[model samples]
Target: MPLGVGFASPAAGVLAATGALAALRAAGLGAAHSAVEVSVAQAALLTVGQYLAAATADEGAEDEGTEDEERAGPGGPPFTSLDGVRFELETLEADGWQRFWAALGADRRAAARAWRPFQLRYATAVCPLPADLAAATAALPYRHTAALSAECGPTATEVAARPAPESGRAVPWRLTPGGATAGAARPPGPGRGPLDGVTVVEVARRVQGPLAGHVLGLLGARVVRVEPPGGDPLRGVPPMAGPVSARFTALNRHKEVLEADLRSPAGRAAVRGAVAGADVLLHSLAPAKVPALGLDADALTAVRPGLVHVQASGSGAEHGPGLPLGTDYPVQAYSGLAALVTPPGEPVRPSLMTLCDVLGGLVCAQGAVAALEARERTGRAQRVESSLLSAAQLLCRLGGDGSAPSLPVCTDLAELAADPRLAPALERAGCTLVRPPWTFRP
Candidate 1:
């Protein structure tokens, strides 16, 4: 994105405050050890480890290669209609996809050929849909397209052609204390770092959950990442920094790792053991997957009372499960953001930047920090939850009609990093890294 992708820039303040407070409070009270729980949902059906959803997914037929990236292609979606209307299409079911294309008069073979890339577009950042599909839309007006979407299967909406005037942003996160466990006092042992002596267990796949954990780790918490038995798939993504994916390292360089499959009994046992000894757990895996691992909130809090459990979902419960598949692009399409963030009368190009995912992480971190503070004060376990859905609403609210985004827009990550004002907050490298946004004092 052209802008700083800056919401997370402020997350540093929230984490810093809680970490420092925990350190000071622990020093005063004297304690040791802590327990934390993190849950993420990355099921294609709707959710995953919040951490992995925006990052590690390889849902397409194959990873779109670098060659695919440079191709002279329209790339995918937010497709334009025949009557001067640009629109976004969304559907969670393959049947819906098949139905939508058929209704548009696209050839069966071509629509089938397009599905893999369409599904994988978010991960690859490119979707080379067959020309037939594009031509189908071009031949018909947007109203026809919209009507077909309504009648056939997929949801379709006209992308806002102009930026709406800006006005506000919704609260980034929501926190609820589970009183499920008012069970333990804060651990003791005077420690350093704003959150010294605090421990955070992170089980995530991609950007959002991991970034939040990164902030927590920066605040001085002992952050442990739980990977599958094979380690993160992203570790192999190109542009390696040392031996791993530079992008992955940029977000996860400092954390410890524990490889285990939450799907296996041994892996579930391994996670339980880790959470028993940590102060907080932050993750974004699917809810359906949670109980299978025997790591649901009630079960885990049973193991260690007062553990802060944070779930970063694609969309919280408020939006219900029937919504489109929960991922960054779909959320952009569904949340009205694809249309809102563009310049007035410009094509609604949702910034390729991980906009809502980043904001989701920042807001989630703030919520996590607040939960930590509450845990310290009341000796009760707290539930902290946030979602890309909420972040989208928040941005739309804060952005107003979207005519003018507060931060100057930029499409290039490199250029955004190069700006003199943002340069200090970023690290120039193979993969840009956002530095801690605040400096803390004792």
Candidate 2:
């Protein structure tokens, strides 16, 4: 344990925590698998660890240079404290897997087999739990919490969970009554048909972009599906079903469908004219080809300043290559999305059609709504871009990691379909539970 030899630093702490979490998760600890909450904790730990390491190093360095004070730690992230701890995760892996494993109730031999390294550079500290609690916090798996909850029954799990109720009162889930209504209540009336008067100009390609427009149409947008001359390439895509297939119809339904080649001047003009009178523009133009298609933000804005422009791409605007330059599988593999959905190093086996498109569409729609609201307030339209990369990254749920999300957000078809409550919700939105494939095809 010489000077910097075996001393614990913030980065060292993050590595230890991440390693501990990984080991616990691999052991099938249910609590550890709760990605949402655990990631927050890990992020905090990393940030805190980074701060301590920096401060300790700065004070100990007798010949510290002025630049050292200004230079941010390893990850170059600003250190901010929350709940008294400041840290950041600089790297996912580092050396010293043996020590990490030993902390998690495993012998050195066992640790060697299971050990993998991680680095955390927390720059701050918080004093909430005692030393014992702090040490246990790093080693504790989420499953332990879950198991404890089962012991308490009904709502015991929620009660014992950390960030506990402010008053230390444990309220059971069943005991909590529903039906708290706010504002003036109005009498419920008869529901109307789907997409009665909403106007939509769908200049979409591939499954995700157009399918989103289709969903909007199903939910009551008067979707005018405008496609190129060859029709949506998906129509001719392999794995074809009957003349019209499930994939196509599943994505498109209840809309005024039109076929036009946007590549042609006349076609582009027609689209411009359509947009001038449309409420929303649904597009999934390939990023590289957006300008060529005359469908960039400026052009669309010129056509209809008030239009809610929603775009979906293979990769988001942030990334240089928006979509896969080649096939879907290769793109998925390249994005690392396929890996998360499938087994490690295995080919991606996506379920329920183009999952990215589906989720991207949903995200695009949500963004469009926000944009529309913004336009209403400011009397100006905003271009909204939701790329495949962004959509994929969101799916990954990389909380506080400063990394983009990486997967589609969706429930399995079976899970949603089986739930009786979800059916009414879908129906109310003007979405047809069934349809022909031709409807979805561009």
Candidate 3:
């Protein structure tokens, strides 16, 4: 029932929905939350695994630093000047006379530069005429490059392209009887659903945290999204639906929106007040910023005992606490995801989709709901932390060995809404597209 554009969105939706369902069950609302079908959650993870497999194979021939060298390959060459041309030769090899001159053309230089380490490696390793990757590529096409690389050893392209044979259905979520207490013990709210009385305060930006908040809203939590006075930066993203960004609408629908200047005392006080009464506080600020803002898990829980605090980051809290803030692209590079998608001896290329961000959001929602369950059972507050790096690792490890079948891309939302397979769910949800992929049966 999940519906969206891009490779990762649907899977992300399923993960989010599953987490919501789990939380509802833990809250003794399982019966009310049922009536949805659940899709497998590991599809995106397996895709990451496939990419990781390819990257690992690409690394087979080199020392540990090889990937680093490849990533640094582009900036090292300045293609506009004579020195740049000379440097290219030193690192790569040329082919035929005609191809050699053709390689010198600006378009080919641009292509070589764009492709980076792959073309560089091929030029350096396979060119009979030293110092001309453009000529080498011109003389030998990508298919030939793949073949020649294969002759030496298992190529990354071949490894990545190999079919993943494993397949299994996702395990359904379940909750024990007497798991969640009802009435006064539950947070007060207005809905008949499992999470109807739960209140969630979201202090986050962009896709990951907001998406989690969105899922919480879908599950019947009263989610209040706190943005800066100027509003969430995502609101400015293009492809607007009237005054708001469509992307923002999709991720943040059904949540109460509040704009506050956290830099001001009044703003801080407002947020603190909101958190003081909330059952869950979801945030995506840098870890350091959390303590500075006096919104760390300990601080918030002190105000509201048994509160579930979920924090999301690009890397684990300890690894890069002071480093430049992380995002999807840099994490992909750092995590070797970019290298994984590249063919052996080719330039690294990251997936166009924001896989890590989407998965990180899913993991955050899952952790948040699970923590809520734990808090309800134990009378103890919990701090749930998730990171893009951790999400990437999960994807790599949890993905099955078998390759997934190719799916045709949906051209637009209209096409998605029109699909016979999704129409029933859409109608049931009373939304334009399919509802959450999972439905619970009482």
Candidate 4:
């Protein structure tokens, strides 16, 4: 005979304690129940143990930052900037970021028992993290960090590709005492690069649109990144390395950056003038605001017959009343995603890939490239668009389906992160689990 332990509140702790007895009382559950023990101390100890484990994990995470920084060098820290989010490379070592989050979701049974009311706040403030530290936090693979920085930012090779910086230096405009002196306009020279013959005028803000431009620039397109008169709000974003900073230079490089008040008559005219010669025009204007900007697809096409116009929206052009609710983070959660992350029954935090922006940006770029190719063949202009919601759905489907993806899994960030040799030894084989190596943070 065995003692039966019961939790007074009918909570899982009580159920787990008498698990064996209950299984013996039932028909098929005898083996599963035999593992249960009735001990409040045991339950509490398990909680304490995991919390302590999380703390140790945090310390190790911090140490990784210190050790890697010394080796990564002053100039080698990875940098990422998009929309208004900015973090210095070192901000990656933020204290307790992952540990605290993991602790919050540790015990589902206890969490469900400890219910509380929710409150709302009107505003939240975000601070920039140190560059090297942020690099550690973004935990992007070291290889990706190096490639993105070199490929996106201005490099020695890139400087060599262009005329000397001073070659295009501008002369101040001055009026002569009597009138203006007529100066000869410089003649345009040379054939275009693959994207050379193509001129891109990007009228966008935040990450998605700018990211597309960044990709285009990488492929030899001449991108003239235009922001409103105040400049892209992202310019004021933090993680500022110094005066000009890496965040700004990292994304807007390889192209001309100009600011104009799109609302003003002169600003609108300037954009229209630029549009006349642009092969592609990218904008993120809200659907309702599109008409006011003189940048609706119809207006843009009228100016440049074969312009490849690309736009990115939060919910896409499909949803009616449901559109406004489609932000990237929430979209990930709502799109059967929060349910699909590995450790099936366990609550997992969402990823930081900003998947929506990345995929949506890629889709827009794909559309622009396809449209350009089509124009070469058919000479017809078209509009290319994408939304955050759709991008998430596509990535989720591709991640796992009955049919396997052709591409390799870039990282071990999946629910089934298991070593075939180690998995067979576990007591519970049916449960989904994710135990990526601690070193796999990036």
| lDDT (Cα atoms) of all candidates against the true structure | 0.64, 0.40, 0.52, 0.42
Q: Which stretches of candidate 1 lie above 4 Å from their native place?
A: 1-69, 80-131, 136-170, 180-191, 320-322, 400-432
Candidate 3 wrong stretches, greater than 4 Å: 1-36, 40-184, 187-191, 320-325, 340-346, 399-414, 425-434
The lowest-lDDT stretch of 10 consecutive residues in candidate 3 is 82-91
Tens digits of per-residue lDDT, candidate 3, 1-442, equal 2111134544655465555546455446323443544454333332232122212221221232334343433332211232221112211233322243343342454333344343423112211222343334444444544344334332212112221222111321111121222323453233344466778999987567776776667656889999888778766543344455444555676788778888988998899899888888899898888888988876765577667778888675535332213565445444544444444454444444557677777767777777666666555667777777665545443443224444574434344445576444443111232244444444
Q: lDDT rank, highest first?
A: 1, 3, 4, 2
Could you estimate the TM-score for every candidate? 0.72, 0.45, 0.61, 0.48
Report the CA-based lDDT of candidate 4 relative to the real structure.
0.42
Worst 10-residue lDDT window, candidate 1: 39-48
- lDDT, model 2: 0.40
Question: Which of candidates 2 and 3 is the stronger one according to TM-score?
Answer: 3
- Runs in model 4 deviating more than 4 A are 1-193, 324-326, 401-442
- Highest lDDT: give the candidate number: 1
For each candidate in turn, give its C-alpha RMSD to the true structure in angstroms. 7.8, 24.2, 13.9, 25.8
Reference-based lDDT, residue 47, model 4: 18
Better of 1 and 4 by lDDT: 1
The model with the greatest TM-score is 1
Two-way TM-score contest, 1 vs 3, winner: 1
lDDT for 355 (candidate 4) = 49
